[model samples]
Target: MFSGLFLLAGLALLLINYVVVNETVPDGTGIVSEVVSGEAGAPPPEMYDQVVPAPRDSGQFTTKVARTAVETFRTSTMRQLLIASGIALVGAAAIAALLGWLTARRALRPVHTITATARRLGAESLDRRINLDGPQDELKELADTFDGMLDRLAAAFEGQRRFVANASHELRTPLAVQRTLIEVAMADPTASPELLRLGQHLLHTNERSERLIEGLLVLARSDQGLVSQGPVRLDEVVASVLRSTGGMAAEQGVTVVSRLEPRLVFGDQVLLERLVTNLVHNALHHNEPGGSVVVEVGDQPALTVTNTGAVVPADVVPGLFEPFRRLDRSRRAGRDGAGLGLSIVRSVTRAHRGVVSAEPNLGGGLRITVHLPGLHRALSPASAPAETLGV
Candidate 1:
């Protein structure tokens, strides 16, 4: 709007200047010239001859007088108009710029509020929100987005605290049970074979409990810093996992097959190996007798573990990898796993900046895939061979 106004003013000024500068100036030629000499320095020639000119054959003496007056009027009017327009233009431009700046600042006020609110919020103060009451616009949308982010962060922090508490309780329960059993055995020397057997059972329970505790610890470490950035031989890691689980696979009539393509990746070797092992174990445990567990390492550096003959429950598959979320309560019912295998796989893969996905196989089974970054040459685990520490 302002630009249009300025352009119109400029055009008007140009038209006025054109009219003033281009008006023709007259050369005197009139009938009054016959009454006076054509010489200069004569005592003021007749007023008629001075103002008018010698008469021309074309009869243009009166036209000359009109033209002279028009020239004089245009020159006087244009000089005054130019001065006025210059002042007006500078004043209009300054006002326009100031108006634009003010409008921009007003439009951005909500953004400033959002920034201030976010800066004021911390881990302990995420409950606070930028409550803006205005018509729906981009600023309102931005505020809504900020509020959603805060909501998610609050829920996540709450979940973390709950997880820590639950894990601690789970770990302490078996230890407490084992401790009571051991105390009772120590108090009585004159005990039966059944009593000794009971003690043995408690010892086994304690061992299993210890494994769960260690697994939890490993998971926490994986979430923290155990997965380092370095080169690792993925083929070697898979080979190691296969060798370690070979005996377990044989016992369950689960034929272990590997179609590995040698590849290197930038990640912690132990974690990657654990991820594959857990997937393989998940497939084996959930399979029928004589079921095939196929571990395929693709040329694209993806690992796929597929098992035969086990239908996964629809609802259970969604939260299948969540920590402490079990698909089955009793081990005797089906696969008697601690239900931590998939969770651990997810954690380890995430630590190595990789992705893990589960899908139903075409031939009546489950297929799990792990895709991670890879390169040409193999890289080894830094510092130490990652081993499970029994805590």
Candidate 2:
């Protein structure tokens, strides 16, 4: 368009610069003589015009030509043409750009929606649908396919969760019966010391099995994401956990040092309590006599648990969060657990849309931090007065 306009503009301005005209003049019918005074020593007489005879035809004439220039570019016609051409060129370009932008935005709208829905998907939070409505084009097909995949995933996860929950419930009855029979047998009047000891060992094994089943149920639930959420006092939860586990800490010969500063987080209260309990219990269980566990609630992460024990290697920290995984040292020390403590902590943190990380402490053991988003911004737990307590 620009090229054509420029060509037209050039042609419109390139007008005739000159014009020629012809005029008829009467011929010299009669020869008129004019004599110039002669200069000294000049051959002027030979160069002078001599009087001649008259022409016979009076119609004979000489044609005289005159040249004139006609200007057309100085008129408003050229100016209006140039202005119209420029406006057309600019208008065409602007319209093209606007249309291209609108087309791209419209085409990618479904893609954006699909991306957002995928990001929000989880084991239990998979109920979203793209449901894009438009012509049966490629983008619409992609969105429909993604929605179907999510539906299938949600159904599979729901079935798996139901199985675990039901199986755990059913297994509880047999464990109860076994415990009752063992107690009744141990109550026999003529039971020998060896039988009593054997019965006690069986009872302890049964208790551990029950703990394992309970942990599995909790782990499964956490993996499904939070079903309920609210603002709960983090410091209070830690305090209660430390107090409740005080007897375990005593039995293990581990000291609990807590610096609790009230902080609020949004999540299920029961899960939050379990999170703290598991952390504290794991710390105590891994520790030796005279060892200490420090628990803190702070600004950056809502909860922090640091314990003193055998030096945990930096490279080995990541495996601690896997279910049924424990350090070689912890396993050799005869620690009694199903190794689901840190695993459950990780699941709970993920369900709450939070991050949990474990780092090897400088001296020994692990520093586990939970960075949970809160319902409302609270004061820095660092600045708040800490209620240091030993349990």
Candidate 3:
């Protein structure tokens, strides 16, 4: 700004100087000629140029004085104008620059606040939100967006915390039970048949542990989105799970019934089969003797497992599918299974872009509904329905 002012001032001064030189040099030369002619006494030619002349040098002196005064006033006025214009220009430029800087800072104040707030946020502080206090502008919108992101982060963090806690508790229960069993068996002296039974219990505990570990690995992989998805037959998976669980259901005095349609869906075949198996096993394990377990598979690739036993308590239904969540402590106490069965089922269903919900059956027990995405409309419909086991 200062440089620009100096350049303009210099140009104006040069122009003023040019005008002054052009006016003054001609008048000075004329005055010198007059003085020289008067001193040489060249018969001040009365008739030589003009008709009339200034009388007795009085008018000439007066005229010279007036001209000198006028010229002096002009020179002084020009000097004053240049000085005043230069001062005004410099002052204006300084004021404008200061005002511009202040305005820019004021405009960007919200941006600075946003940067500082974001810098203070981290994984542990994902719940922190920004305070947008200024006018409603783009900055305010940006703050709103940032706040929304923080909300999502907080929810995700909470979910992860819950999952870890539940997983740890579930994994610890079976080991604790096995330890107690071993301690009891060691304390018994005539532990012949008792010790043999303890060995069998330990073996069952080991199997439960193995199953828990395998389920955990599958869930972990599903969470990481490691499984491949394609068109698969839901009826086939259901039938396989039924065949696998047939013996267990029979031993429990539970009758397994099925009503299935040949439905196709896009999903991982292994995970889908596991999901069906877990649901059937959960239903049969919770049912009473002579109770019937009903399994239904539809064209939408939805499965409903209904068992006749004790009705599920209303309060526990909300979290029934969460890990380490069990409504019947008696049922879970002696069992070596980690209570992640339903949790794994829920996880697998979700991984396949599906939903699982449990509700109390009208008569006595619980009914679980698993909904999965079916194949595209372009595929031809299946011709036959398939039935499977109860467990």
Candidate 4:
């Protein structure tokens, strides 16, 4: 566009010069002459006419000089004008480009906002919206549409969470009643051997059902989000979990070894404890006899639990965190597990704004790591008393 404008300006200047030159230099049959007398006092010459042939038409010479002057003036003026116009055109183009870039960036500001909001949106954060404030333009309409979708999604997730929580609560009572009835039947002295065996089986089944319900409730609660938070000592939490599971570990003949360091984080203590307990229990339950379980606590990756067990394929480690996911022939034959340990671990970790990962060990068994944000300063191990449990 700039080039076209420059060409037009140059052409206009050339046309004007052509018209001016044509007007200033005329075309006509005219002659210029000067009269000369032989002497002032002398009479007119008698030989021939007194005019001396009119000095050979000096008008043509005068016209030639005039045309030369006009052409020179026109050429100089056109040269300067062309240089100035070229510079001006270049400068105007640069300025326009700069202004256009800035305007485009400003116009797309809402698009950037929408992208960030979309990246942050998730199952837990469906309530977030891109509440853009501006005139009712196309971009504004897009933002409004996105926010409306999030509203619908938030409502749906809320309904699902409520249903799960309610169902778990409703099932608790009947399960408890069944467990009580089975225990009473087993305690009756007149009960036959077959009846007592059936009662024991019923009791076991009821207990398993109760555990499942409890796990579901915990998972749903964690998904809803944190109720309260405070500074929690991760090392202390690990110690507590180890204490709770020491007997089980001993029964399974899995040696528990730990190198715990003082690490402080902000979260619900109960959920944190549950996270540790689940990981530790999973490590102990899936281990070979006389194998070892190692627990490490530090700042970066707040906790790590590695245990010796049968070889686990790399591909199967990811699915283990999904609800009710179990590895083929990985668990002990007679052991009882609800298969929600890793699922609860993941949920609780996410609730605390942390990450959890599992990997297959090169030799055998699995390694699980949990990474959580840490406080700036926390109590040292010496200042905080350490607790130990018999294993």
- Number of the predicted model whose lDDT against the real structure is largest: 4
Q: RMSDs, each prediction? A: 11.7, 13.4, 16.6, 9.9
Weakest 10 consecutive residues, lDDT, candidate 2? Answer: 62-71
Find the 10 residues in a row with the least total lDDT in model 3: 43-52
TM-score for candidate 2, please give it: 0.73
- Provide TM-scores for the models: 0.52, 0.73, 0.51, 0.73
Superposed Cα deviation of residue 145, candidate 2 (Å): 1.2
Cα lDDT tens digits for candidate 2, 192-278: 999999999989889888888888999988988877778888888888898788778877777788877768888899999999999
Give the lDDT of residue 245 in candidate 4: 86
lDDT-best of 2 and 3: 2
RMSD of 4: 9.9
- How many backbone clashes does every candidate have? 8, 1, 1, 0
lDDT for predicted candidate 3 compared with the true structure: 0.72
Question: Per-residue lDDT tens digits of candidate 1, residues 1-391?
Answer: 5555665676677677656554542223322232233443332233344345646553355445544544455566667766776777677767776786688788889999999998777544568888887989999999999999999987886676568668777878868877786868856889878878877767666766665676686676566534246787676787788878877887878787777666677777767777777787777777777878877776453788888876766556768889766655665522454567788888887766678888776676787888887775634434223232111
In model 4, which range of ten residues has the least summed lDDT?
Answer: 29-38
Q: Tens digits of per-residue lDDT for model 3 on 100-139?
A: 6688788888888888889876544565788788678898
Shift of residue 209 alpha carbon in model 2, Å:
1.3
Off by over 4 Å in 2: 1-95, 329-334, 377-391
